[model samples]
Target: RHPGWPARLGPLLVPVGRVALRPPRLLDGGAWSHVRTRDRAHLERWEPTSTVDWADRNTVLAWPGQWGALRGMARRGQALPFVITVDDELAGQVTIGNIVRGALRSAWIGYWVAGDRVRGGVASVAVALATDHAFNVAGLHRLEATVRPENAPSLRVLQKLGFREEGLFRRYLDVDGAWRDHLCFAITTEDAPEGLVARLIGSGRAQRP
Candidate 1:
């Protein structure tokens, strides 16, 4: 385990208005699987290709193992995997991964929202909360995110949170099936002296519920 790990293994709650983030739970498998299955077409375009059939019962049965793996990583301080909630209901996920301490003190941020929940600022608020935790609570210096060039909504989420465009990476990640070009966006602790969530709220891009 990393020496800098949070004092407690988390269900760490970061809430603002109706949006909240919490660690993923073992029992959430069914709901999580359902959302992914239902949003297959909606999400696959931006997601890495997966061979598993999300709608299959076997896939749902595998949730515990997946959750366990993430939990282990969290325990080791390698990642922060959080499920986004709205009005206490599952809405999406915001994950802080690839943490590198010491000289770098950086991590990667990634997220997705349920199809029906899109355009409501759920992604923005969830990400802001996660970024705040990564910087303030988890003691990271910088956070980075990548988006496919065509993912306008996701690009907007990063932009609204004040992440600066770093550059573009060709064939950066495999999406759906083919390798796709991606734009890199990053934010450092110095970028938001007041906190990312506060910056987001002040910009009028996110509102209190």
Candidate 2:
């Protein structure tokens, strides 16, 4: 977790057309449960459940002490978190978490597209929106993602979004009980094509709401 990250990150409302990227809400309990189990296998490798795994919906259940600690850190500009949803259904989660400002106007982008939704290219379009939201809405300038070298699906998502392969970082994130090597990828505001959303969806991948 890097420090001083909030100043560099911002907010994004789901763009008008791609309705799947709507903001998740606390009352979405039934749907959230559905996605948790649906995406369980996909997420476990990237991020383990912490005491705060359900923090987005149940803030009160968070360890009061830990909540206060994180709130203080947030108040002081340390990090930001967001939940991702698809067409009013909980399909995944995306976070521009671990922000680092100043010279590093960057944040680590992490996401998962539900197993049932894979191959539909839901993530490809959603990610472009997320990155644009981070830059256009959040006012951040750079976004990066890391994936296990074996994760071809995720890598494809990055490629589809025009993220350049940067390099590999060995033993990066702990997955399913072991640390794994990851290939890094990124897309900057400058590298993105204008009207990328239309292009991605128009390719006949994203099903409009």
Candidate 3:
């Protein structure tokens, strides 16, 4: 963690058509759990084993603490934790975590969407928006993301966002209880000075929501 970090983050929101990006709220625990439960099987193959039992209703009911912690990290300029919504319904989450300041000025981006929203251009738009926020609002220089080698949908999302493939990492992370290889991808502020969301829409890599 960097020293002298800000003590608070926001009240942040970014709108994109029917979709908007904002921080998680205490009242959203139930909705978040419902979406994740529905998508658990679908997400398992690509995600790491949960430290918490996601299927347990009681665990979900306790999410306000987790949400608060997420906001705390954001307040320190250590992360940007966001929930994506479509017409006020919780559709997904996009987080820019592992923030490094000083010489690095970078962070990692991660996200997941509701089962029904996969391939509906939600991921692309969400990624673009987060990328813009990282560079413009967070004042970061670079943002990175990694995908399991076999995760085609995730790869497509990064591609649409114009994240350049950096290389491959062997046994990069624990995923679904197994060590998995991953493909690294990244985008730098210098790579899209005009704003990544606008770039994606203009280049037609992703349509305006």
Please tell me which predicted candidate would have the highest lDDT against the true structure. 1
Score candidate 1 by lDDT: 0.80
Q: Best by TM-score, which number? A: 1
Whole-model lDDT for model 3 versus the true structure? Answer: 0.77
Compose the digit string of candidate 1's lDDT tens values, residues 1-209: 55444332222232333777787888888788888888878887887767865466335787898789888998989998888877677778888888889999998999999887788778888888888878877889999999998999999989888999999999989887898999999999999989877777777766555
Q: Model 3 Cα displacement at 86 (Å)?
A: 1.0
Q: Model 2 over residues 1-209: C-alpha lDDT tens digits?
A: 33323332112223322334543444555555566555656666566434434435333333344445544554655444434554445566565666677877788788776676666655666676667666765566788898888888888888877789999999887665677888989877788657456556566655444
lDDT of each: 0.80, 0.61, 0.77
Q: What TM-score fits each model?
A: 0.89, 0.71, 0.87
| lDDT-best of 1 and 3 | 1
| RMSD (Cα, Å) of model 3 | 4.1
lDDT of 3 by residue, 8-38 (tens): 2222223333566787888899888888888
